[model samples]
Target: MTLVTDPTAPRIAIVGATGAVGNTLIELIEQRGLRYRDIQLVASARSAGTELSVDGVAYPVHAVEEFDFAGVDLAFFSAGTEASEQWVPRATAAGAVVIDNTIAFRMDPDTPLVVPQVNAHLLDARPRSGVIANPNCSTIPLVRLLDGVERRYGVRQAVVSTYQAASGLGHPGVEELREASRATLDHPEEVYPGKEFSPSLAFNVIPKIDRFLDSGFTLEEQKMLQESRKILGLPHLDVTTTCVRVPVVNGHSEAVWIETQGVVDRAELVELLAALPEVTVHDRRSPHEFPTPATIDDPYRVHVGRVRVNPNNPRAFWLWLVADNLTIGAALNAVQIAEELIARGTL
Candidate 1:
C-alpha cells in the first residue's frame, strides 16, 4: 500500500460534517492518518462555526455555500439527496471529484456507483460524470461479500432480509430508538411524539424500512437489489430483498440466500469467503458462535457466518452477514474511492 504524500496531496472536503456518517468520515480520516494537503468540513448554516478536532488540530465547520471548491481535489457528500443534488454539481463544476453518499447519483447512468473493495477499478476508470456515488448501507456490504461468489459461480438469483439499525435514519432516529427503548423499560404509555417507527422499535422489528414502492418492496430493498446488480455489472441478475428496521443502534445485519449456476458446497463457500480481503468468515458450529451485531460493531471487515447449502436447492446457499453501517457501509467506502482516485492519478 503506497501512500500518496506529494506536496499536491489532494485538498479534500467533507460535506455534512455534523451528521452521523460525516462524523464517522472525520474519525476515519484521523484514525487512518490519511495524508491530505488540506481538509475542509462543510455543513448546513446552523452548524457553521462549530469546531471539530482531529489529531489535536481543531478545524471549524464552515457553511456549505461559503466554502469554495476551487482547488479541492475530492469532496465527499454525506448530506441528504437534496443537498447533494444542489451542491454536488457545483463542486464538480469547480473541478472536484465528488463521492456522494446520498442516493442522488447512485442510479444515474453517468455516475459510477462503487464499493471500493468490490468495484474499485470502476473508480480508476474515471467516471464519465465527475461525481461517483456510494451504494446504500444495506447494499455496500452485501455486494462486497458476494462479488467474488457472483463472478466465480454465476449468481442467478438472491433473496435478502435486512436487520437494519436505527442509525440509518441519522441522529434523530437514534434518539428516537434510545428514548423508545427507555420508555418501554419504564412502562410508559407513549414513547415518542407519534410512532417513531412503523411499530415499537424497542424489543420489536418493523418489517418496513424505507417507503414502499409500486413493486411492494421498500425503497431500501429495491436499492439493494438494483444497486447490487449495477455494481456487479450483472444486469440480468434476479434479486429480491426485504428491509426491516431493528432496535440496534449501529451495525446492519442480513440473512441472505443466493442461487448460483453451479452446485456449491458449504465448505467451498466458506473457503472462498475467508480468502477474500476485508471479509471475515466465522462459521464455527461446535459452540454455535456466528457473526452478530455485538461482535462486529465498529469493525471495517464484513463478517459472514451460518454458511449452509439449501436443502431444497443444491445450487443455492444461505448465510448471515454483518457490517458497521456507518463505516464500511458509507464513510469508508467514500474514503476508499478517494484513495483509488489518487492512486490512479485520476484526482
Candidate 2:
C-alpha cells in the first residue's frame, strides 16, 4: 500500500472517461478542487483521441489497451463490467489502487465493496485484491442513509422500490429517451423500440431494471439487497427491492420502508437523519415539501424526505430519497474512497 505524502501529487487515471459516470468524476474533481499532480483519461478504442476538458484544460483520451498505469496512484474505473473484468487486474498490477464502479468484482469476497459515507473504515486496511468496488448506483445513497438508522434502531428488514433515472443506463439511455419521445410525438400510433429500455421510456416507466433473476428480482434490485447487507454488516437482514426505470434523466429516487427491531420515535428519527453527513432532511407535509427527482439541488447530498411511521406496524417507517445517480451514486463515492485511503495512508 502507498500513500501520497504530498496529497496533491498523486497520479490519477479515469477509465471510461467518455462515459457519463467518468465525465461526472472529472466534473466532481474540478468542482471539489481535488488536485492531482497528473490526471489521465482512458477509454475504449473507439472513444480514443477524444478531448475532455477539466478545469479549462483539455486532456486527450487514451485507449485503455494502450494506457500505461505506471505512476498512477489511483485509477477510477467506471467502464462497464466487461471492460473492468479485462483491465482492473492489469491496472492494479501496474501499482495503481483501482476503485471500480462496476458489478464485476463487487460481490467477490476479496474485493471490499464500499460507500464512503457508510463504510469508509474499510479503507483503513488495504484491499488484498488491490481493488475496491463502488456499489450499484442505487445502493450507495440507500445504504448511506440507512447506516445510522441501522446502527441505532437495528433494522430488521427493508422494502425498497427504486425510481431510477434513464441516465442509470448511461449516456445512451438519455439519448434513447429523447429520441423515443420525439418519435412517439411524431408517430403516436407506431411502436418505437427503445435502445436501452425494454419499452419506450419517453412517457412511461419500466418496472424492471437489469435482467430478471430466477427469483423474479432484477439484478439491480438484488444489488440493493446484497450490497446493503455487505455495507451495513447485516447478513441476516431481510431486504426486498423492485427497481424501476423512470422517464427522468438524472436523479434516482427510492421509496423505502424500513422495519426496526426496537421502537423509534418520529422526532428522534428526523433529528437523527438531519445529523447524518451528506443527508438532507425535508420532511414536512403542510407545505408539501419533500424530495423529488426533479427538485434535487445538491447532487452530493442524499435528499431524504416524507418521513412517516407505518400505520400498519409500530416498528415500521417510510421515507423517500433522491440523489444524482451520476455523482453521489457513482463518481463522488468512488473518489471519496480514494481520498479516505490517502488520508489513512493505505492506498
Q: Per-candidate TM vs. native?
A: 0.95, 0.96
Angstrom error at residue 136, model 1 = 0.7
| Candidate 1 residue spans exceeding 4 A from truth | 1-5, 194-196, 284-287
Model 2 alpha-carbon drift over 4 Å, by segment:
1-8, 284-287
State the RMSD for candidate 2.
Answer: 2.6
lDDT of 1 at 168: 92
Clashing pairs in 1: none
Point to the candidate with the largest lDDT.
Answer: 2
| Tens-digit lDDT string for candidate 2 (57-120) | 8889999999899879899999899999999999999999899999999989989999878888
Error of 1 at 83 (Å): 0.6
What lDDT, from 0 to 1, does candidate 1 have?
Answer: 0.85
Residue 154 in candidate 2 has what lDDT?
A: 85
Considering summed lDDT, which 10 consecutive residues are worst modelled in model 2?
1-10
